[model samples]
Target chain A: MADKKTKNVFKKGAISSDFIGTSIAKHQSKTTIGAHNIFLGQVRADVIDNKTVAAIEYTAYEDMANEKFHAIREATFKKFDLTCMHIYHSLGTVKAGEICLFVFASSPKRKIVFKAIEYIVEAIKADVPVFGKEIFEDETHQWKVNK
Target chain B: MTINVKYFGLIAEITTCEKERILFTKKNVSEFLELLYLKYPSLKNKDFQVAQNQELVSQDALISGHELALLPPFAGG
Candidate 1:
């Protein structure tokens, strides 16, 4: 359950819906997985001080971010009866309405996957060293903070 | 000891560089930060955490690693 190897959890840009669909299709052969839960984080067009955010440019301490992601994966496996889990986050610019984060968890049962998905997503939000720069419509920018 | 210090997010904006090598003979995190504060005083006003060798450590932790990072609030989803 404790996976020792670290995997890269970052992508260059927005995670395409097609990619997510392909991922799901690939798992069809794994008939042991009875349920899959997914969490997609879309960039929001937030209006702040009359400025609308157009996109988010994400960056990270890659070495630390990957290690933290690996730790979260290991913890999730140990805590749940999940068959597998995958997490991908955008590293560069992700436009508003585009997917920036994708989390998928599969399990033999439905309940485990539901819980596992939430746990992984929350851990990523709180522990990962990824930063976001909100680019406003006027080309101005501000750092994003997790709430 | 020369430490490879990394800055991320707004921390990099404040330092004006993403990475730098600091010649530090410090004993702990606080001492190393004090040295940094003298060089970049505005960093003192920023909210960030310290990571030594890719692991978060307290301010009193010993400077045992060759790499250090200044990380701001995480916005990861």
Candidate 2:
């Protein structure tokens, strides 16, 4: 995505497989992009003290998170010869084994997309102010922190 | 100045409100945080970063924005 316009990367609930498929299909007209890399963040069913996580409810400082996403998009463009990029993150409740985050990057060369995708995802994990509450099977919840 | 302070994640759980308007006559972020600690004592023990006008600011940074946010650790993917 171009940095000239700020795009709201947050999506409600889990990002559907259909949406992701549609996004990939949309780029067919952009013939310049030869390589594409994607990163999908899935919620794990981690057991802590015998309680298993069932889902994650997300929240964010929307205005700031959008700003960080925009910065990351701009930085990725500056660092790589990327043709386009799209980032979508889930908000509200996302169940286990569901998709919560999707980062897609495209470039002319395979190597550029590989490095660009990782860079965008890592920056998102560190810079964005999006919060997650891990809800257990028993309904108890705990705040999640990036390790 | 009246600042609109917002709390997120566990920090909001402590404040029990997402956002509020406070009549703050503080000099810096630390001073403003002291006021918040007095109002919500549990917030003193929590870890967070202050954002002035949607940008992260240091504790020593002066209170210059009408909008402020208390953000906890990022778990975003």
Candidate 3:
């Protein structure tokens, strides 16, 4: 039951770097996995119709986003034998080409960790309620959800 | 009663404010939307979602005096 409780971590808005690092350290155990896989998502500067995107502003319906994130974390744990997992997303304003999300998963072996990492990242992109705003160098902006 | 309504993304652009309190009938979600649309006709066709008290709900869902938010389709990484 304690193991089940440790599998999911969700918070409103962006997660700090210290939180991500500490979460991994807390889950480290002798009986747990020897290998951990992490995936970090960052925004990129892309030109759309001759306008270059300078940065991205991230936002969320905080109440709903938090609920959805927690639900997804629980679902991921049930689907896999993960020793632990962590997910963090940005909120408010994040510049283009900046880090937006960090996902880390560890298990008992290489195979499970690899599979779990893929699953968690995919689930976050597909299911989470976080949204992004694409800011152009020209000072215009547009909102986008990860696809 | 007057309830506070929050707008995000493109919806904020139309409303010109992030939060506002409007006089509304104590009606279901759909009825409130009808009133909102009448006030901001430009929002009638834009693809957006709604949430009450931080929970996502369908347009026709029932709501009463809860915090409401209008979210345009999300574009986050």
Give the candidates in order of TM-score, highest first: 2, 1, 3
* True contacts recovered per prediction: 0.96, 0.96, 0.54
What does the lDDT come to for candidate 3? 0.73
lDDT for model 1:
0.94
Model 2 per-residue lDDT tens digits across residues A84-113: 999999999999999999999998899999
Flag regions of model 3 displaced more than 4 Å: A1-31
Ranking by DockQ: 2, 1, 3
Residue ranges of candidate 1 with Cα displaced over 4 Å: A1-4
Candidate number that wins on TM-score, 2 or 3? 2
Looking only at chain B, model 1 earns a TM-score of: 0.98
Docking class of 1: high
TM-score of chain A of each: 0.97, 0.98, 0.80
Give the alpha carbon lDDT tens digit for every residue of A5-117 in model 3. 32323344445667768877776554657778888777788888899888777766666766766776788788877777766777766665566788877777888878878
Q: lDDT tens string, model 3, B1-77?
A: 78789998778889888898888875677788889999899999888778888777886787765589888876645
Candidate 3: residue A135 lDDT (0-100) = 88
Among these predictions, the greatest DockQ belongs to: 2
